[model samples]
Target chain A: MQNETADFEITLRPNTGWMQLDLKEIWSYRDLLFLLVWRDFVAKYKQTVLGPLWFIVQPLMMSVVFTVIFGNVAKLSTDGLPKMLFYLCGQLGWTYFAQNFNSNSATLVNNAGLFSKVYFPRLVVPLSSLISNLFTFCIQAATFLAFFAYYKYFLHTEGLRMDWRAVFLPLLVLQSAALSLGLGLLMSALTAKYRDLVHLSPLLIQLWMYATPVIIPLSEFPEKWRWVVALNPMTSIVESFRLMLLGAGTVEPLYLGLSVIFTLVVLVIGVLLFGKVEKTFVDTV
Target chain B: MSRPAIEVRNISKSYDLGSIGATSLKDELERLWKKVRGREVSARKGQFKALDDISFDVQPGQIVGIIGRNGAGKSTLLKILSHITEPTSGEIVLRGRVSSLLEVGMGFHPDLTGRENIFLNGAILGMKKAEIREKLDEIIAFAEVEKFIDTPVKRYSSGMYVRLAFAVAAHMEPEILILDEVLAVGDARFQEKCLKKIRAVAGGGRTVLMVSHNMSAVRSLCDHACVLHQGRLIQTGDPEECTETYLGIYHPTTESGVVDFKKPENETAWMKRARLYCDGQLGTQLEMGKPLSVEIDFESETEMEPGIGIVINGPEGAKILHASTRNAPSPSFRQPVKGGTIRCDFGEIPFTAGRYTLSFWFGGLSYDTHAEDPCFSFEVIERDLWGCARPYQAAHSILWWPAKFELQG
Candidate 1:
């Protein structure tokens, strides 16, 4: 026997491959992913004493931590904006990207039993994870919006300042998702090969948080070292969300445009790599 | 193989087991550096060839069983056929829809109910959504979980889980079905039903390729069998012939009708000897509804009372008859019985011919007396039936009926 794949010229019958990631099939299975997401959501809250309130409780707690550690303690300026809103904008972007990335990256390993026994484009697992993460991100975003509304009218401050830039916020959220999907797919493909990626991923994601402008504003960086921060793909994503939602900073068209281009490029390449790897990942995984 | 549905040509798979077993980060990193640049990279360490130069064809509407021991590459073959793992070399041309039941409930999410999972699992098995919708009721009915169809499958028993999984896979009606030891789940009764469903699926005229250690299942369902020993093809022919070959190849000491028992022989007030015969033939078939005799040779080394009897267990694990010589009035021959042979002949044999065993007791052991069963064995051949109402009783639980059968999906 040799180490070569046999692609016997089977009759060109239309199969799942022919279906070619048909969006219609995906739409039909959308319920499956929805239920899985709901299951995860419910299971998370089920035993927790706080229940679904944890969704609201989590970000609020994180907001307090950021306000103390970055705002009061470090005296990090939020571009003269309320510390809560400033961090909330960054938190939304960071939460969406990180949650989607972690879940999607582990999709293959998480369903290793299923993949070895059954055949479904293997892409479905990660895609399903992406959907669920989207749901979680939505919940968190809605909570943040509630906070934003309350701060705007009820608090009675310039904190209510309006900016037309917020309308592009959806695109920013979408870009974060695309970035996550790309990186997640790439890591998933690699993790199947190097299982060490399983242990390495979370630490890397945490370290990556520091590299991106997640906890602190990109403005706080030393002028000499700003270029490096600007180079991180997530740096622009975080900055874009802050600019769009908080209206605290001006958009660097070059950086934002570059982030968008990178997102599209990585998305295409990630999908291709994902497809190619899924063809025989069972062996390595 | 006629009009091959799945053809595997010159396929092989090799697995590299790195020097260290999988461990946590601390252990892996310590070894990763050593494993990467170490001399253990070649002959002494890395590769183990799981399958080598394996090739076979599964014809459309043909049921082929691949029989092998634990590591003789059965799984590797199924994996390649399903494209879950690509073959190391060569090519496989799959002609129709290929559904592999290598593991049941493979993609089922515990969060989903049986209804939702049927659709998800159907898609994973290669059925389109509309097709799954059409088969939903059939699947639910076949699984016999209608009451719990809308409830989460996590609440289902393991038997129910596999049943639902099998139902979904079967409903797909794939042109080809590849199963890998997935039938060992669920209750025995459910297993029987699953076999029936598989037969029905095959009756639909599609190809099936199965790998199972259970020789009975292979013999009952497969039209053709391929034997694999130590990662090489040993034989391919009728299921019975292939199984015999595979068994002989693996255990050289094994002989026809001679079970390899390790205990030393003993004959003490025990029916130490027994044999099954029909029409004075040895180790041969018996006709159903014919007079038959079971001879038991025992030793009354101690002494016997009125409760001593013989037990003849028929095929299908049925205890068909018990004849006792103990109850007979004391000695018509005017000789006290000690060690002697007793013969029991039935005016009519109710058993269908296949295989059965005989055992006896010095007293009513069924009601608590002393008796030892050497685990005797026997086979009942199909009654040579000619024309009208032959009174044929099948000795087996499930009949192969000798048809070249294939199960698709």
Candidate 2:
């Protein structure tokens, strides 16, 4: 059979010639996206003992572990910043990135029932998942600020301070969201056809954290080797986030610009691949 | 002629059945390699076509009923029109916002309260927040779950679940609404209410495309109907006429009271042939107050102790009589009863005069092995009226009893 070529307001064909983002279509379904995010946030904490408080407890515990292992045992320098405040700040952005990656990568498979029964922009699933994680990130960030205030004022930590670049925290969060969502979309589209990709994702995200400047400061790496690790787009985001929030790391414009460019490219490729896969994923999945 | 609300042109969907089985990485890589080399790709290995060159137009404000036997591309057509799945080769031009209820209660989380689920489900169905908020009270009243609206849906009864789910779907406002067998939910009274709701929705100058097995509902509700047979469009026109053609296609005739089950539809039961006769004569019409016999010819591989049954339904699909080996005589085949004909005879056929449908069934360990609906239909004639002062018509009562009247003087 040959593909159909027809003209109408909404023409459904086998495959379109080129990739189209249809941002307007996604915008029109904004209410649906909000509801989806609301369902995720509400349902995630529904029957739990701690409820949404677990959102705070999780990153706090992880930050404590990072302080013990990387600060006490490895003796990794937090660039002369307080160990507790520095680890909590670093955990803030890294946890959101990891959570978004984990959930958004499974969006298609998890929503197979909804996707097969309805007709909305398929992008809404992953987009809502990223937004839902932002809720948890906000709570975690508040807890981080609470610690930063206690250590800086009560404990009089001289090295720990906020700079004018702290205003750039929103930009850093957006960067983290874009990077995770881009890679998440790409993996989600592939995992629909290859079940093995689903099994490998958790380990990939773990190794990715170690490769980024999550637990260790970017200055800890040798000068030559630092550039190699800086190739990871997340490296700049993490470094810039710490530099802005705690005034400890360098804010290199070249590396930050590279990360932004890399994020945009991945976002474009991810959107195109995801759009193509969604048209027929129901059949294969 | 008004502009068509939905135009489906040369639509066809073919599935690569080969991929469903190749769950391993190596097999997928091999398939990819073959595609790169421009090979025949396993030469139609397990390939199947779900829909073939199906084209149709539905006018605005028209309620169209899609009818077909099972596996006849009815659901496939709905899915394509809903944009859930893309057609292999076709284009569908839908001129308005389309909401397809291929399933009701699609994303209702059990952990969510009934009130929250209503908003979530409405949003998933493409309703704006303000729209859902506006219809919230009416939806709650219709579902009759107002008391438990604040409680989690998981704690509700199954009947309540279906009611709430269907109520949300019924309240949706879309330019074109597509429903598939959603009317089969809820109780009989609720089903009637849903049908009325659907009729009201279509009356408001919106296009509706519904697929249902309820012939009576389709006949009463749809302005136009289409029949699909084995992945192809067989007929499309007036609702009553199209429905009659669909029923006729399934109601095959028997020769000398015997139907040869050589067709694929008949093989579903592992049955070779069947015969129905009355008083030892091969006849298509039977008289009331007479002996009747039903014979089933089946091929069995095991000891063959499966239950066999026959259901007699009226023209409107109401079951008049259901007789099974377990229900009545408790007949059991002896050890190792291999392939052969089993006959069950009734001393008096207690049915009134009219056309009745016969459906056969065989039950297996966990599920029904085979079932044929409207497999064979025969007319019942009142040969003798029993010299009654008043005669009863078949439409008046389904049963014929031997009633005797005597004066006490």
Summing lDDT over every window of 10 consecutive residues in candidate 2 chain B, give the lowest-scoring window.
Answer: B261-270
Q: How many pairs collide in each candidate, listed in order?
A: 13, 0
Inter-residue clash pairs, candidate 2: none
Worst 10 residues of 2 chain A by lDDT: A1-10
TM-score of chain B of each: 0.61, 0.79
Residue-level lDDT of model 1, residues A8-42, one tens digit each, is: 23432112342234466456555555545655665
lDDT of 2 at B37: 93
User: Which sections of candidate 2 miss by over 4 Å?
Assistant: A1-9, B21-24, B30-46, B261-273, B287-291, B296-342, B347-375, B380-409
Any idea how many clashes model 1 has? 13
| Alpha-carbon shift of residue A106 in model 2 (angstroms) | 0.6
TM-score of each: 0.72, 0.88
Q: What is the C-alpha local distance difference test score of each model?
A: 0.70, 0.83
**TM-score of chain A considered alone, across all candidate predictions:** 0.85, 0.94
